[model samples]
Target: MSLDQPAPPAGQDDSTGREFTSALEDDDVLRAEHVSKRFGAVTALVDVNLHLRKGEILGLIGDNGAGKSTLLKILCGFQRPDAGRLIVNGEEVQLRSVDHARALGVDAVYQDLALINQLSVYHNMFLKREKVHWPLLANRGMRRAARNYLDEMGVNIPSVDAQVASLSGGQRQAIAIARTVYSEAKILLLDEPLAAMGVKEAAIIMELVRDLKRRREVSMIIIAHNYGQVLEVCDRVNLLQHGEITLDKQSKDTSVQELNDIVVEEYRRALEQRQRAAS
Candidate 1:
């Protein structure tokens, strides 16, 4: 039973291969165990266990009703899990609020690319953390800091004074990402971020992701429609079906066809098992 929740964001209307084997050797960032949720008679998730490691990407994929967003809401502290728990950085903690997630160094970026339309790049940069003097916002200080942050990330935005509404899709994406990282987000969750972007733009985003991981200070979970994109950036892939994780494989060991075949077979087996049970 599917609930009447809002739809997920558009996924790459314009457009991974290998090399994820050793990107993550001994790093673990976020861990979820046996997590489940339900609304009335509809069960959104069940027995979902996933581990996201530091300095590498983890991919989450499944068909539409497979509860990807539901799981994300739970992780982002928008919704509470009806069962199981999460362990962060080896510590058992309850994410009772979004603040809890933020406190735990976790941050999520939506496909909408949340940014203030009327605000300049510099204002958006510091946002709530803008430098202030005598209870007044110090514009000069914030612009200087924004410039430094963009330079630090190797992102070349034209001007911090430009409003987000005026930026292109890709540039807006870059700004949003820069803001998240600048805000001290340690664990970043990107939800279909590349959707609606062109190939060149998408490549830029991917490169930025790689740069962030190379910095080794932030871990990320990237959600994409194509297995190739996931395989390209993710150290590991975790596939979900009917609320359960059906496939958890290292990107180095599996091909996209193999991933699809596993899902198809698992589905076929489920049908057969149900028929036998009915008989």
Candidate 2:
């Protein structure tokens, strides 16, 4: 159903609503159904069902240790779920590895960024996928391409020849995102893209995100702690709690205060459980 539409009446089995949701699923670029994951005694995820619509930005928010990262890893094929099906572009397929996911037009950008500090910005942009001319490295071609791509994406950097370590965090982050987008990733997973960034830097990334959304070219799922920013940039938001998604709503229908209250309630319940166990 479109986020702008009103929800169906509770306890009412509206056949029309069902059909609408089904049709919406058909438009989803990515979906995880009944996905579960465990690490020995730790259950990282449980029956998680999430979907990313085409050309949409979905904000995923949760408290620390709430399995948000685990879910992202599963979606990006960095980790596999013990049970469930992953649907990409309406096809259910098992992702074997990160490369396999990337081959399917899915890519993830983690906070670490995985960029080499010693490498020049242009070199880092084409890391591991550098262009070559016979036996010689295509330095000139790569530099030109990287500079052009950055300019096209409106990401500002001092120079493509500058070392990555010399740039600010926002610039580096922008480089990482631009590289992924340039790689033709249709479904992008961003893990804490705004974390630890200053206001100006965060603003740059936020603007970039909005621009991407405006283009309506790629679907994105962003994991963030800032509810305000999420509401500002995302089309929809999902709340993860205790290894499951408990809330999914359009960003316009929710507020930062409402999200904060729900999270605080979860904390209160957890604390009560601990007291009961101790007693």
Candidate 3:
């Protein structure tokens, strides 16, 4: 956005045009307005405004060095955008640290579950944030909560006492997802979550994403390099190029080719813009 570019018409939200029914008329869980991030002489993001709707799975995709991770990091409070507003739930907020984001009910589950393999499902799920008490830990209570949460998520695991190391690949993935959901994770950012699973396991993860979307409070942002995964899980796709948003398309109306074209074209346009600025 530039000074010459006219402002968005007063009182109208930009996200409403997408019309995601699961999202309220004004439900923008995450919003980055005119954001810019820089590292020394490098500008990682510039003039970016992205909105994640409630209960909608937004696919954040880009080629290498396209600032996908950087943008996500900004949202996660790992990095701060030097020149924009960080808004959550329509309020201008400052993401001072990673803990700040987590406290606000924004959690990110990376490709790795950050789980301890030697531990049982219940132990892993309640690892650091346990239901603790003086003199004795609440083991039974934690296991009960784990079991109930898994059942609510429609996941069938043999027992919460089973070691995570013994679970199948898909079951392990589910365990990670299940843990996040139980943590009151209202906004979930999944980084390449489905890239490493087998066919059945991957399908399970995909179904879980869809199932989570039914709730009005749980919005998801799934990052994937694979176009097929984006098409399958995303309600909308945000394509970035050299730290700027090049395309934002609804998954239903946008094709894979369009995403590819936008990616290529944005790179080309970026090169052209750089050449012109240099000249």
Candidate 4:
């Protein structure tokens, strides 16, 4: 398969016998080229290529241990790729740290949310970049700004003064994402934003994501297991398999059944390999 075209879906032949063109354009906000990573004896990624277009939501899905989190970490500069190049806004650059990535308008909101339960919502929003009045912290200013930003993002938290521990799972997740946006991150990497939440809570976050998409002020790469939600919010979808992106298609061009089938086929192949090794 050509680098410009993704491999056909598992079990499906390339009947057209023609290469599919890449969706990437000059407007791509981020791009990863032949990225590879290894730890000790294990390989996390191999020759991975992916891109995020400006003002677009790209869904990344894969089975557990498929190196999805590793890719996100590399993209956000939490970890570095042993090989390959990372490009931001058409410029190839090396990210020395998470702060460096943030400085370049790239940031990630991991599943952990990274908020302090003991801190108030406003405090968590301004975690390390807190405003200070030289001798004392600017508590009132932060509270007001936090409230306004949340309201603008359509996040409905009870109060900016409320402790993060007192909020529900979904509420906490929203605050995490809101805080990232408030920091002026133009490229957001969301690692399982809807991981463990009730239906209503998940809907709240789904709507928040949709609102962000509507604004078109930021580009996002969302790592999600829920195929339905992925299709609902993303403009495009990419499937990572065996440490490489194997399928790239617009969400409207694919279905949940197709994605599930591909994943199930991967599971079957792994089982067969293990059985053969035992023999």
TM-score of each: 0.81, 0.91, 0.80, 0.90
What is the RMSD of candidate 2?
4.2
Better of 3 and 4 by lDDT: 4
lDDT by residue (tens digit), candidate 1, 1-279 = 012434334452223111122123225678787899999899999989888877768888887788887887788776899999787776667898877887888877776766889999989877756789978899998899998999888888899888888988888888888987888898988877787999999899999998898885688887777888889988888888888888888899888998888778878998999999999
Model 3: which residue pairs collide? none
At residue 99, candidate 3 shows an lDDT of 74
* Cα-based lDDT for every prediction: 0.81, 0.91, 0.82, 0.91
In candidate 4, which residue ranges exceed 4 Å CA deviation?
1-24
| Model 1: residues with Cα > 4 Å off, grouped in runs | 1-27, 263-279
The TM-score obtained by model 1 is: 0.81
Task: Output the number of the TM-score-best candidate.
Answer: 2
lDDT of 3 at 128: 64
Candidates 1 and 4 compared by lDDT, better number: 4
Judge candidate 2 at residue 106 and give its lDDT. 95
Error (Å) of candidate 4 at residue 164 is: 0.7
Residue-level lDDT of model 3, residues 1-279, one tens digit each, is: 224545456555556443333234366788887889889998889888888977788998988877777788888787888989887876778899877898888877766777788999999887767888776879999999999989988888999999898888788878888887788889988877887788878888888888887753589888888888898789899888778887788899898888877777877998999999999
Report the candidate with higher TM-score, 2 versus 3. Answer: 2
Ranking by lDDT: 2, 4, 3, 1
- For model 4 the TM-score comes to 0.90
- Candidate 1 clash pair list: 12-195, 16-228, 16-229, 16-232
Can you list the residue pairs that collide in candidate 4?
none
